[model samples]
Target chain A: MVKKILSVAICAIVLLFVYAPILLLVVYSFDSSKIINIHEFSFSFELYKQLFRDQKIMQILFNTVWLAFAAAGLSTILGTAGAIGIFYSRKRVAKPLNAVSQIPVINAEIVTAISLALLFSMVALYRTYFSLIVGHMVLCTPFVVLSVLPKLKQMDSNTYEAALDLGASPAQALFKVVIPQIFSGILAGFMLSVTLSLDDYIITAFTKPKTFDTISTYVYNAVKNGTNSSTPALRALSALIFVVMIVILLVINLRARKPANKGA
Target chain B: MQRFHFSRKQLCIPYGLFLALFVVIPMLLILFYAFTKETDGNLSFSFSNFIGFFTSRAKLSTLLMSITIAIISTALCLLIAYPIAYILARSSFRKKNVLLMIFILPMWINFVLRITALRELLDLIGLLESQNYLNTLIGMVYDFLPFMILPLYTTLEKIDKSYLEAAADLGGNKFTVFTKVTFPLSMPGVISGITMVFMPSMTNYVVSDTLSNFNITILGKLIDEYFTTYDNWHMGSMISIILLLIIFLTMLATGGFKDNEKEARGTNLW
Candidate 1:
């Protein structure tokens, strides 16, 4: 009984530590005062109103969403293909490829961002949507591959061979039998890719066009520039993002339970 | 023999090209920039950036300070995360996913927004400016604790209870069973968690820049300063190469690239 109580206490404390900052931000979103203060502010929806009224912010929101999906969609395809190739290939080729894929993950994001910037500049593709999307792809693809490789490993290795032997063409075997088996992993990887692309800032900042702005870059600039009109609006936007994210993820989680028929 | 089968080369071609284009080529660019110098309307390979880094006291000290800060933050994260993971793994909760979800919920928000919120909270407390190191450490620990906990929980949850039973059956006490059977078995997760937290804390300049109000200077922040602030590509590339070597050495030390089955399972992090 004491052990259970101790465990619960520890969990609660840790949760508080993690949640306090976000909760604080959520509260600041509602404050109408110009300066951010914990207390002594009237509760107003002014920031939310401003967030909606701003045309540039609104357009950037859409751009950011489209960019996220496009990048996630592209990376999912590339990363899934890469994972499949790595898992099925000979060791000599697979080992180096496998290790190489982890470079973006293991290396610092600043380094990755600058490297991409330099690469883009070399081809005069710097600060274009194409460069930005590729930057996100670099950020997210390795993770997709990492997530999918495990599912491929957990799969029955001979399923592809069996499908081929049973008169299914190679493409048919891969598309039909193998892909279905790893569908859960791919779905998870897709969700992760979306989240990663959405949450990314460094890579987004360095690779994006000078005129472009995502929620991350906008909020980063707003905060860094200090108390301004957009800063207050960004507080509202951040709070809304947190709430919407929770709602979407909760819905997905509840929905995802139905397809978790891995063993049962 | 079959009429036709998929060959390895065909499957590997596209991604191999992508990797070469982005990963291999960009890396080569960094190396090229790092080793060469632009002089009198011509570029020549030289060791100036590297020599400058070593010769400059400020640069070396910045690297050392960054390492120290990273170590402290990583240690704090591990200390706080382990017990939470252990409790979650050992509990007999029917809806455990909900609990795990609570821990990861912070990650859903834009990280910059989250740090901005932290800045406000610290501002209210009057600690943001006065306590630079402590506040930065707090932000690092907060941003990274979930990364540490998730892997630890995954590995701990996978531990066979029978091992503990066997140890207890051999007259081991609770602590003895943990130290002998449990801790040893969870080494893979511990290693994974360490690398995940350690590497990022070293280079996540965003946390320090936000939490410290652009006061604190870490190696990552230094690299950005060179490339963007000073527009010194040669120096920035040199610093990146050095940081990469440090990361490589750290991964080697932590067995992060090992293909052990247990390690792979532990490292299946999202």
Candidate 2:
């Protein structure tokens, strides 16, 4: 009983450590004061209203979301196809290809960002949205390959062969038989790519044009400039993100529980 | 079946071309820019950029400071995460996945936002922009602790219970069983955890930037300044190459490359 209590206590403390800053962000979102003062506790929704009213913040939000979507979508398709190709190719060809794919995953983000920045400048494509998209795609695609490859390995190769033997065309066999088996991996990869792209700052900061600012670069600039850095609207944005995260967790939990309930 | 018009080899072309264009070529570009100097509209091979980096006391100190802070933060993360991971792995908790989700949910939020919020809280506690190493370490561990815990949890969870039982059956106590049977098996996770935490912590400037309010200069920040503020691409590329070398050495020291062959599916973040 004591051991169980100890374990629970440790878990509680760790979780508290993880959530404290988020909780603080949520709490401060409602503070009416311009600056964060622990002593001042004025409750208001004006910050959230202001967040919605701010055009620049809205633009940043749109850029971040659309960029994430584009990067994730493109990387998923490319990475999933790459994984399949690696799996089917001969060992000699596949080994080096697989190793090359992992370069982005293992390399430091700063290194990748700088290298891409250098490449863009050398090719005279610097500070373009195309550069930004390609940079993010480079950052995200490897993980997609990594995620999908495992699923491909676990899948039975004969399923596709059987589909071909049963009068299905090769393209049809690939689309219908092979893809469905690896769909979960693809979905996971897409989600991971979206999350990584959404969270990315180093690469985005390097490759984005001067006028283009994602939420990350925007927040970074706000903090760096120290002018209106502590705007309640920013806090509101944090609170909004925290709430969205909570909603995502709850939805994931509900979805996870449903299958178990059906099983039971 | 044998003579289908489409070949699997053809599928490799797009990604292979992408790898060459983006991955292979960019790295070559960094190397090219790092070693070549532009003089009178002509480029010549030179080591002046690299030599300048080593000769500058301030830059060398920044590099050392970054390494020091990374080491400290990685150590702190390990210390805090190991026990929690052990508890989670060994516990009979039915909702472990849910608990894991709770831990990882914060990571889903934008990292900069998390750091911003953390800076605010630290400001409240009189720690923000104090130029305190402890403050920076706290921010680093907070940002990175999940990376440490996830690997440790995965590895610890995979240990066979029968080994513990057998150790106990041989009169080994809890500590002995853990030391003899559990710790050695979890080394891979520890190594990966170190890699995950150390590499990012060393390379990450945002955590220190936010927490220190741009007062602290690490190697990453130096590289950023050289690239963005100073327009010294040659120096920036040289520092990046050095950083890459450090990463390569760290991976080698940790046997990360060797383990890749055995666990080719890749590192698990989920």
Candidate 3:
């Protein structure tokens, strides 16, 4: 009993450590005063109102979401195809191919960003939308393959063969028989790609054009100058993200618990 | 000869092309740029960037500082995450995923926003400006805790209960069971967790950048300075290669990319 109690105490404290900053941000979002003085503690929607009223920040929001979806879509297709190919390949070939695909996942983001920048400047394509999207795609594709490969492993190895024996072409077998079984993995990979692309800063910063700005680059710039960063609007935005995360995680858990549902 | 053909090899075309063009060539480009330099109005491949980085006292010290910070933050994250993951995995409660979500919920927020909020929290406690290194450590631990916990929890949860039953059946005490069985079995998770947290903390300049008010210059920021402020790709690429070598050495020591461990990591991840 004492052991269990100790475990509970430790878990609670660590949770506090994780959530304290976010909770503080949520509170400050409602504060009327700036400059981190909460002694006055006048509660208002001042920061949230400011966040919505700012035209540039709102535009940054749209740009960030739009970029994430576009990048995620392309990477998902590339990654899904890659996973399927590797899953179907000969053992000797697949083993090395699988290992090679993972180099990006393990490399430092700075290294990846710099290498992409170097290669783009060779073709004079640096700081373009194409470079930005490709950079995000590079960051995300490996993980998508990783996610999808396990589901393929869990599936029966003969499903495709059976489909082909039924007079279906290879393309038909992939699109009709195999894809449905692994659709959940594809969806999961897409979600993961969206998150990674959204959270990315280093890659985006390196490859983005001068006129483009995401929330991360914007927030980093607004704060990196000094200790007196006046961008409290991020506080409200942070709280909003926290709420969305809870909803998504809960919905995922609930769906996972039910064996019947696939969320497609 | 005129007819089109399709084969399983065709599926390899897109990713194979992607790997060659995007990943392989770009990595080779970094190596080229790292070794090449402009001297007397000519671009020539030499070891000056390597020599220059090693000869400078400031650059070596920053590398040491970055390594020290990464080690400390990685160690702190492991210490805090292990028990929480252990509890969450071993809990009999049905709604433990909700509890897990509480620990993971903070990660979904933009990390820069979270760090900015951390600055406010540190300021409220009067530690932001006065103790720059401590705040940086605090911010890193906060930012990276989830990465550590998820792997540990997943590995711990996947351990067969029968192993514990067998250990107990053999008259092993709780202490013996943990040290002899539990900890040994969890090594894969621990190694992966360390790999995930250590390398990034070494170069994730934003953590220290947000936490310290220009009082610190870690290796990542040094690379950024070379690439941006000085327009010195040779120097920047050299530093990046050095960083890559450090990562490669550390992973070699920990068996991070071994085939067996790669299989262990690439499956069952949420």
Candidate 4:
């Protein structure tokens, strides 16, 4: 009984540690005050109004979406090809290559951002959206590969062999056999890449064009300026993102639970 | 008898070309610049950049601070994660799945968003104004808890409960079984989780930057300052090179590349 109580206490504390601050942010977003003090909270839509009307914020949002989508598409194509390639090769080479692909996922984003910034400056590719896209893709492809490789591993080797034996060309085998089987994995990987690229702040800040401003970067600048109160806008945006994400996850989970007959 | 597949050469073309151009070549360029000097009159190869890194006290201190923060955050993450992971692994609660999802859901959100949320929360509670290091440390611990929990949970969930049962049947107390059996068994997960937290924690400029403002200057922040605000590529490159070397050596020291091989073979764990 003591053990149970102790476990429950630990769990509760951890939850509070994680979420209480988030709740506070949500509360302060509704604060009518210029400063973010939760105790003096009063409802206000002024920040949201400002947020929607801000031309700079809108431009950054567009840039962010562009980078996220472009990187997601590129990583999915390259990552899927890399996974499929590694899946077919001998263990000696494949294992090392797989590890090489995963290093970016585990490496510090700051290290990577700095490296990319240096790379672009040295190569004279700085101050361009292409540099940002390339930087995001490098980090994102590994995650894509990580998500896709497992499904590839689960595939039976004989299916490919059987396709070949039945006189289906290699392209035909890949299109008809392998592609259909791994489509869900690839889709999941693509979504994961998009989310990661969208969320990335450190690398994007370093690698993006100086003129560009992502949502996170905008928030950082607003906080640092300390002249204007932007907390409400930031919080409202976060809340909207959180709600959308949760709904998407729930829908995906429910869809996953449906009968296998509906899977197709 | 099999029809032709895309040759390995053909398949590797685009990705190989892209990786070489963007990933490998750029790194090599950084390394080259790190070891060279741009002469006032004409650029040339030299050791001045590296020498400057060692000579700078503040830059060196930032490196040490980063290492210190990474170690502390990783240790805190492990301590907080292990018990929660244990409960999740051992408990038969009806809400276990929901609980697990809640634990991991934070990771899916934007990292900046989460950190910002923590910042606002701390500001409201007056924790951010703490005259000491409490706010930064606690903020980091909260942000990184999930990274530690997920890996530890994976490792703990795979542990055979029969070992615990067998230990109990053999007249061993729960503590004894845990110390003698469970703790050692979870070492792989522990190592992986520590590595996961450590590497990222070490290089993250944002967490320290936002949570502590400019008061806590770590290595990543140093790099950002030089590269952006100062426009000092030589100093930035030197710092980048040193940081990369430290990271590379750390990876080697941690047996990172080798451990993955053992993990893939499923033989790394004792």
lDDT, candidate 3, B1-270, per-residue tens: 677766555676798788878999999999999999998879998999999999999999999999999999999999998999899999999977667767766665678778877888998889987898998899889988887887788789889999999999999999999998998999888988888889889988888988897688888888888988899999999999999999999999988774332232322223
Query: Which regions in candidate 4 have their CA more than 4 angstroms from the true location?
Result: A44-46, A90-96, A227-231, A254-264, B1-5, B258-270
Q: What is the C-alpha lDDT of each candidate?
A: 0.82, 0.84, 0.83, 0.72
Provide DockQ values for all models, in the order shown.
0.54, 0.54, 0.53, 0.42
TM-score of each: 0.92, 0.94, 0.94, 0.90
lDDT of 4 by residue, B156-240 (tens): 8789989999999999998999999898898877877776677667666667767775478777778788878987666777787
Model 2 Cα lDDT, one tens digit per residue, A1-264: 998888889889888888899999898888868878888898889999999999989998999999999999999999998989998999998998988887888888888999999899878999998999999999988888877887888889899989989999878999999999988778778887888899999999999998999989988888888964656699999889879967875685656554312211
Q: Could you tell me which residue pairs clash in candidate 2?
A: none
- A204-263 in candidate 4: lDDT tens per residue? 888878778887777666666763353456666766666676667656554454332122
The predictions' CA RMSDs to the true structure, in order, are: 3.2, 3.1, 2.6, 4.3
lDDT by residue (B59-90, candidate 1, tens digit) is 99989989999999999998998998899889
- Clashes per candidate, residues 3 or more apart or on different chains: 0, 0, 0, 0
Over the stretch A1-264, how does candidate 3's per-residue lDDT look in tens digits? 999889989987887887788788777778856676767688889888988998988999999999999998998899889888888789887887777787888889999999999999999999999899999999988877877787788888798899899999988988898889988888777887887888889999999998999988987887776523466777777777766766776676655654422211
Cα-based lDDT at residue A12, candidate 1: 92
lDDT of 1 by residue, A98-207 (tens): 88887887778989998988899999999998899999999888877877888888899788889989998888988999889988778767777888888898899889
Regions of model 3 farther than 4 Å from truth = A226-228, A258-264, B165-171, B258-270
